[model samples]
Target: MSKASRYEWRDQQASLQERMKGFMENPGTEQLQAVLTEMHAYAAAAQDGSIDIPERFIAFS
Candidate 1:
């Protein structure tokens, strides 16, 4: 790739990484709900006997 193209790709990657970092740090309501729902469902039915939980979560009973 050309120098300019390489730079552009790097910039895009950096932007995506930053966005992901921010999301992980503070996800919105929808994101939090979806994750909780998924976890609840997994807990209810763990067919695979394995689940990957996120580093942050809040489950309301």
Candidate 2:
């Protein structure tokens, strides 16, 4: 990629890392639980064929 593009990508990555670090330092437990619950629902849907995961996708974490 061009120099300008690389710099922009690096800036975005750095910003995301900082945000994640803050979240790790102070997690919102309720929010995290809600998201995990939603993800489980999606996994269930995929398993039951109500929705489909991409072929060759590995097991969900």
lDDT of 1: 0.53
Write down the lDDT that model 2 would get: 0.54
Across 1-61, the per-residue lDDT of candidate 2 in tens digits comes to 4556455544544454555565567789754565556556655755775543333424354
Best by lDDT: 2
Worst 10 residues of 1 by lDDT: 45-54
Candidate 1 structure quality by residue, lDDT tens digits, 1-61? 4556455544544454565565588899765665565446555533543433334545464
For candidate 1, the clash count comes to 0
Candidate 2: Cα lDDT at 36: 58
How does candidate 2 fare on TM-score? 0.46
Q: CA shift at 16, candidate 1, in angstroms?
A: 0.5
lDDT of each: 0.53, 0.54
